[model samples]
Target: MRLLLVTLVCLVGLAPALASDLLIVTEEFPPYNYQEDGKAKGMSVEVVEAVLDEIGEEAEFVFYPWARSYLTAQNRKNTLIFSIGRIPEREDLFDWVGVIAPFNTSFYKLASNGAIEIGTLDDAKHYSVGVSVKDVIYQYLKGQNFTNLKVVGEDILNIRKLAHGRLDLIAFDEASFAHRVAQEELEPLLFRQVYRLEDLSGDLYMAFNKDSDPDLVERFRSGLRTIKENGRYDEILMRYQLMN
Candidate 1:
């Protein structure tokens, strides 16, 4: 009878970790998480899949707008959102699995527009700065009280605006910006890096809802550690050509 009772308790304790019904949400952020050929593919997606496989779990991935995905992940239980910034404001909202990748953000300006010179963030604040709405870079600058700011819904819109002289400057992760420029056939040489926001630039992480099972989060962390230790993490980065 005692053995039966102990077995029940142990099973109850292991339920969370052994169960694998994780719902993963992401946005259409290229090279990280995006739809390719009617299927989900990207560096972040592959990383998440590898970690889940390592932990002997499966996740259902769905893409939505960044705002909708963020809200859904916040309110739903046992939900996960990836490639999200581990920013100060959102630190207490979710259980952080770990950093999946680094997102090096920087301010940029057109090289032809030599009229502006930005040595500091403050110097660039006077000009109209374009940023994707609800982006970490936008949130950071807004928190810093940047006055002349232009918020757009789409990230590529900012690049287009910057190219057309609608925005004096724009901010985005270096990889994303380069991809957008290449996709739009915009001259990469036209835009020059003004200032890299090292302090504000944060790593991308998978954040689980507050009500998520702690054991499940720990499983993901353990899997991530395994990949890093075995050098599979670096292999994924190289596969995406994200190494710098």
Candidate 2:
């Protein structure tokens, strides 16, 4: 009984360390989350940093391609990923921290293409659609049996392809599309959203690996809740002009 008690105490003491040290990872999904000047910066980054400040913690953030970040967050322990979709297929894969940003995906076509009129998701199927491989949009569309999907290594590439008329359409985040369009110095009239994927309209979330310390996850969750209630969340969003 004494040995059991000592072992229990030791395990309890180890829990905080198991969770406190985290490696935060994400892809270059701008406006929401991205790296600039070799440092993490964006709407979601500000939110995460605010939460950390509230919780009195710090962690290193690493940005990589979507697939690498996704796999690293999945295969490694004590990993947290942000601005990622909370899709059904990924439901049980991680310990979800909390929703961090708004995410709405839609099928976009060049405004110049007056010849294309998609009245339904099925109608858009006839055109070649660009999607980043392993991205939430790609996964969702592929699962929906979209046969014309043109997989790319990154969503930014999809933007360039669509701009060049290389793709008939592209699955893209609504807000990110506007941001990227402006970033590429392209006119907003160049493209328009033809179809909104209601199924993919869920907000993005921050999540720790399935095996991460639950206590640590709860701390971040609580910090997020506190910020939302205290107005810090809204302040950050307003600063970014992302309040919607």
Candidate 3:
């Protein structure tokens, strides 16, 4: 009886460590994941939290700069990155689940500038364009030998540069750029989305480390599907004014 009791105690001690924990990485991209009122609140955060809740797991979110966050997700164990675009080069780097949102890459110009008519990527070849550094859209443009492109460290800077005439055009995710414009009161700058790159339509997903247990990834995926079906996911998105 004492031997059995000792064995039971050993099992109990091991149970908590055996339970899965999710490590999440995010950046300060508003309407997705950002801090407000001393809390991590956004459409992606709420949606990810709901999924974890449904799966009987908890998450620990580590906020970092965009580049650092991407690298952390790439190198760390049990870590997942949110709102990452599904790109061809990054397709196999991690286990993917939950295409949390879809956004379009667009070319924006000042409202008063009607002279610059950008109907396609090739049309803007002559003018200087700004995009976020290490962004998928920027990489795509670079690969096409688009010579007049500049990289900004952050998305907000790209918008500001365009507003200030430092750049002729800016390429960014539509939702993110719109949110920044609204928040920064840049409406007078005349933002026009000239071309929506269909190939660059970003499918945002929760990507876990490749070495992560497949069962855990599937659990999260199942939970995400459930939330989508039950309308919880949509409601969360609506709360953030993200869903159209």
Candidate 4:
């Protein structure tokens, strides 16, 4: 009984520390989240940092593959994943923080591939679609009942496959697709946006594990509101415009 009492006392004393500490996870999504010269640096990183600062909280960030990050955020206590789309399948899985960045997903085909055309979401069904494995786009397509999808580990691989004529259509977020194309010095005009997934067009958010303290999430939200009101949010966005 004495040992039990001591344990409870220790835990009570450690509660605030555990509540304020967080393990933030993110993927290498350029302009939003990525590594620069061996350091975690990006627009989302800056925004998250600013909000944590305002809320008097501290977090350590680690970059992981999206699938791993997503899984971790789903299962680990106090784990947060940033720049994730809040899809319906994930609606109640995590405590969502508001818009960290904008996301516009679309189906793209090689401009040279005049044979392929997608006028609507239904029209895309007949053709082969390339998607990143375990990505929100993949989930979205699966939800839409798309069967002819070639899932790759990296979205960049889909770009390569699309260019090589391995896919009839590829799904990608507009900003990320453009960034990757530019990174590879590929001609952007080579790809044409055949159709935009209107339903998938929404702002990305920072999401915490479902088991996280609700008060902590609210505090972060408050901090975010403060930053937006103070113009720091817009400032961060503008500072990263060059990357976008």
Best by lDDT: 2
lDDT of 3 by residue, 73-117 (tens): 777667778878887778888888868876778888887787899
* Candidate 3 Cα misplacement greater than 4 A, ranges: 1-21
Clashes of each: 0, 0, 1, 0
User: Could you give candidate 2's per-residue lDDT for residues 1-244 as a string of tens digits?
Assistant: 0100001112111122334367787777889887666667789988888888888877767666777778777877788888899888899999999988877889999999998888888898899999998888888888888999999987889999999999999989988888888889999898888999999996889999999888888999999999999999989888877666
Clashes of 1: 0
What is the C-alpha lDDT profile of model 1 across 1-244, one tens digit per residue?
A: 0100001112111123224557787777887877766667788887888888788876667776676667777877888898899778788988999878767889999999988888877888889999877767888898888988898877888899999999999988888888889989988998998899986675788889999988998999999999989998889989888764
lDDT of each: 0.80, 0.82, 0.75, 0.80
Model 4 vs. true fold: TM: 0.88
Q: After superposition, how far is residue 130 of candidate 4 from its true place, in Å?
A: 1.2
How far residue 142's Cα lies from its native spot in candidate 1, in Å, is 0.9
**lDDT per residue, candidate 4, 82-195, as tens digits?**
988888898999998888777788999999988888888999999999997777899999999999999987778899988888889998988888888998789999899999
Tell how far residue 39 is off in model 4, in angstroms.
Answer: 1.4
Q: Where in model 4 is the C-alpha error above 4 Å?
A: 1-21, 241-244
TM-score for all models, in order of appearance: 0.87, 0.89, 0.85, 0.88
User: Which candidate model has the greater TM-score, 3 or 4?
Assistant: 4
lDDT of 3 at 112: 77
Model 1 alpha-carbon miss at residue 6, Å: 41
